[model samples]
Target: MAGPPRPAQPRPVWFEAAADGTIQLFTPSDSVKLRRPRRDPRASIVVAAPPGERERRVSVTGQTTVEAEGARDLAERLAARYWDLDERADDLAAMVADELIRIVRHPERVRRFAF
Candidate 1:
């Protein structure tokens, strides 16, 4: 459950890159993502360059921690960052209220690759 994601089952999740350089995302409290990482604190997140851009990507391998605080706020911020929340306001509020865990990864190794 550490380093680059399992290529056979890579999950595409929305994430926020914190100013402190940690990668974060919210998941249901009982999600496998939370379960696996709890049993094994090693994890990695790979982000590819945006569409219409040159081929490049970044991979971060790190120790992960699940936080109980700030999940709602983080969710709101991430939703706005990645979507036009104006249309999904209700959906956002509803999902934010669900039991959620914040997965924060503190990077031990960060690699950048251009292909």
Candidate 2:
């Protein structure tokens, strides 16, 4: 038997590859994306390479778990990676002070394609 289809809500996110080959993502504690996974750990992520002569893409399918304790650290790392956090350390710290969630995906399979 099948139930009602789940709603699709897509949003851009930054990700980092962990040494263990898992993907790490950070989101606000209030985000639905963070909440929904608790009910269903299954998840997938797709990333497309910058536009060029050929289009390249990678997809990962796996299960995710919320790591609350690591969220702050990961959020700081992400902020530093994407922005000059050191220049405005106070602001960055204040921003991350709000509840954050760390979502770690254990990759079950990975697929890459180029066109």
Provide the overall lDDT of each model, using Cα atoms, as 2-decimal numbers.
Answer: 0.86, 0.85
lDDT of 1 at 10: 72
Estimate, for each residue in 1-115, the C-alpha lDDT of model 1 and write its tens digit: 3476544337999898899989988987878777777777888889998899999999999899999998888888889987798899998988887988899999999999997
Off by over 4 Å in 1: 1-9
Estimate the TM-score of every prediction. 0.87, 0.85
Q: What are the runs in model 2 whose C-alpha is more than 4 Å off? A: 5-7, 86-91
Residue pairs with backbone overlap in model 2: none
Candidate 2 TM-score versus the reference: 0.85
Query: Each model's number of backbone clashes?
Result: 0, 0
The deviation in Å at residue 53 for candidate 2 is 6.5
